[model samples]
Every structure is written in structure tokens, then in C-alpha cells.
Target: MQTEIIIAGFGGQGILFAGQLLAYAAMDNGLETTWIPSYGPEMRGGTANCTVIIADEEIGSPVVRNPQVAIVMNRPSLDKYEPLVKPGGLLVVNSSIIDRTPERKDIQAALVPANDIAEQLGDRRMANMVMLGAFLANLPVLSIEAIEKALQEHLPERHHKLLPKNYQALREGARYLAEKV
Candidate 1:
């Protein structure tokens, strides 16, 4: 199986980091993965986006003109990439920033209050992790155990203590979805 996901937001929102973590987790699950980040001239306050591909077979390209899933962390990202998701695909939106829903009925969408959830969990920085957890819960290609292991291996040495918090954020997201669904 192959899945293409695009994570887009303004810089400093951890959009790229979220993509990298997802790619790492996919790789840890023995899937072929590719992560392509596009900062372009928008490196500062402008829009940033990353395309991550996870497949059981070889990945042909990293560029995702139309992705199967999109994780949008801001209004611009939601407005910019919402049209690019395929039919029946998933669209995960950061509801704190984007109050509007996608106009298309072809895709399934989830509005996650990531920032608020992260803040309640005691670290606003784990907003991305919360979203990642929701993504994992919605897309079951990578197991939670594999994602936790990947997080342990991928987190920087200096931030090792944050792993448990991140894990908690993930669980919270999962629980939120469970309650909603």
C-alpha cells in the first residue's frame, strides 16, 4: 500500500518536523518513505509545505501534486492545499487557526484543536505531536508502537525528556478521536 500526505503551514509551526517524524515512523515500519520539504522564498513567515510518501513498494517520486492526505496547520495552508487532496482522501485541519471547512465533499476532513490540546497537556510545542497522533489514529498504516519507537529514536538527545509528553499528547489525540468517532 502507498499513501501520500502533505503537511502545510506557516514556518515555525513544526509542519516540516511533523512530516519528518511521520516519514521516520513509516520507515521504521519497514515502508519505503520519502519526505520532500518546500520552504522556497517562504522560509520566514510565508507558507511551508512538505510531501511525505510511504509505500510498501519503491516510491517513484517525492513530489505530491495531489496527495491522499493533507494536514493543514493554518488558514493559508488550508486554503492553499485543500483543493489538492484526492477524492475520498483525508484532510486534517488545525481548527485553532482554520475555522472554515473544505468546500469539497470528495474528501473526509477532521478539525483538530491541536494547540488547545497541547496547551492542556502542558506544552504548546507538542501541538504537532497531537496532530500526528490524530493522523496515526485516522491512518492505521503505521502502528502506535512503531511510532513510539520511532519517536524515541528520532528525538534529539537534548529533548529526550520530552518523549513521554509527546507520547501523552499522542494518546490524548487518539482518545479525542475515539470519543468523537
Candidate 2:
């Protein structure tokens, strides 16, 4: 299977990190993967986005013009990428930050309260992880074990203490979808 995804949010929201984690997970599973990150000059508060492509065969390019999956964490991201999802594609939205809903009906939409879930987990920054978990719930593209391993491999040693919380956040997101569907 081939999946092209775009995860977008403001700079400090871990948009790029989320894409990296997914790519690492795909690589761990022996799938071909590519990740590209983009951001404005004012990183901290500016818009940030990343494109990730996972496939069973060799990837031809890293850039994604029309993604099959969109993980939009904010209103602007939703406004920008919602229109770009391929028909019948999946759109994972963070409802905690975005009050609006998807306008398109041709694609599947999963509204996840990622920020609220992360807050309940005691760290709002983990919204990305929550959203990631929700997005992975139905994709079956990568296993949670692979994602956890990727986190362990990519996170700095000094931040290892937070791994458990991150894992919890991921689980929480998955749990949300389970209960919803």
C-alpha cells in the first residue's frame, strides 16, 4: 500500500516530529518512506508542516501535492490542507484547537480532540502524539510497537523520561477512536 500524508500545525506543535516518527516507524517495518518538513522564518509561532510518504516499493519523490491523508492540528492547517486530500482520503482533525469542521464529504473525516486528550494526559504538547495515534488507528500501515521503538530511537537520551507519557498519549488517541467507532 502507498500512503501520502500531510501533518500541519503551528511551529511549536511538533508537526515535523510527528512526521518523522511515522517515517521511522514505516522504515522499521521495512517499508519505503520519505519525510519532508517545512516552516516559516518565525518558527515558534509560525506555520509548520511535513509531508510523509510510505510505500511498499521505492518512493519516486518526497513532495506531496495532494495527500491521501491529512493530520490537521489547527484551523489554518485544516483550511489549507482539507481541500487537498484526495477523494475518499482520510482527514484527521484536532477538534480541541479547531472549532470548524471539514466541508468536504467526499473524503473520510476523523475529528479527534487531541489537545484536550493531551491536556488530560498532563502535557498539552503531546497533542501531536495523540493525533498520530488516532490517525494510525485505522491505517494499519505501521504497528504501535514500531512507533514506540521509533520514539525511543529518535528522542534524545535526556528526554527519555518523557517517553512513557508520550506512549500514554498515543494510546489515548487510539482509545478515543476505538470508543468513537
Candidate 3:
């Protein structure tokens, strides 16, 4: 099976990092994966997004005009990607940053309060992890165990100290499940 995902938000919101984490997990699971990152010249506060494709066979391309999953971390990302999700796919929304609910009903939606959950867990920057957690829980394309291993094996050594907190954030986001906004 194959799964295509897009993670998007402002540049500083860890959009690329989140996609990298997914790629790492896919690799750890022995799946073929591709991660492509994009951003605007405005830098940190500007638009940033990444596409991740995981499959059992060689991926033909990194470009995905319509993804099976979209993890949008902000209002603008939501606006841009909502219409692009494939019907019957999944849309993970960061309710903490997005003010409006999704208008599409054909796809499954997970409204996670990522920023709020991260803040409650002691760090607001882990919102990306939270959203990723929600996506994994709902879709099952990649196991959380695989992601944890990726964190331990692939993430930089200096960041290892934050693993516990990051794991907690992931769990908390998963716990949210299919909550509606």
C-alpha cells in the first residue's frame, strides 16, 4: 500500500522536521519513502510545507497533487490544502492555531489542539509531533513504535534529551483521536 501526506504551516512551525520524522519512520519500517520540502523567501514566518510519500515499492515521483493525508498546522495551510485532500482520505488539523473548521465532508478529519497540547505538556514547539501522532493513530500507515525508533536512531544526539517529552506529546495527540472541531 502507499500513502501520500502533506504537512504544512509557517516555516518555523517545524513543517520540514515533521516530514523528515515521517520519512525516517518509513525508512525504519523498511518502506520506500520520499520527502520534499518547500518554503517561501520570507523565511520563518512564511509559508512552508512538505510532501511525504511512503510505499512498499519504488516511488515514481515526489510530487503529489492530491495527498491521501494532510496535516495542516495553521489557518492558511488548512485553506490551501483542504481542497486538495483525496476524498475518503484524512485531514489532520491543528485546532489550536486554526480558527475555522474544515468545510470538506468527504474526507476524515482529525481536529487536534496541537499547540495547546504541547503547551500543556511544557513545550509549545512540539506541536508538530502532536499532529503527527494524531495522523498515525487515525491512519495506521506507520506505527508509533517505528516513529519512536526513528527518534532514537535518526534524530540528532543533542535532541535525544527531549525524546521523552516528544513521545508524550505524540501520545497526547493520539489520545485526541477523531475529535471534531
The alpha-carbon RMSD values of the candidates against the true structure, listed in the order shown, are: 1.3, 0.8, 1.5
What tens digits encode model 1's per-residue C-alpha lDDT throughout 130-171?
888888889877877777888899989998999899899888
lDDT of 3 by residue, 76-118 (tens): 9999999999999999999997999999989998889899999
Among these predictions, the greatest TM-score belongs to 2
Model 3 regions lying over 4 Å from their true place: 178-181
Whole-model Cα lDDT of every candidate shown, in order: 0.87, 0.93, 0.92
Write down the TM-score for model 1. 0.95
Identify the runs in model 1 with alpha carbons over 4 angstroms from their true place. Answer: 40-44
Q: What TM-score, computed on C-alpha atoms, does each candidate reach?
A: 0.95, 0.98, 0.96
Top candidate by lDDT? 2
**Shift in Å, residue 69, candidate 2:** 0.2
Least accurate stretch of 10 residues (summed lDDT) in model 2? 138-147
lDDT score at residue 151, model 2, on the 0-100 scale: 95
Give the Å error, residue 151, model 2: 0.7
Ranking by lDDT: 2, 3, 1
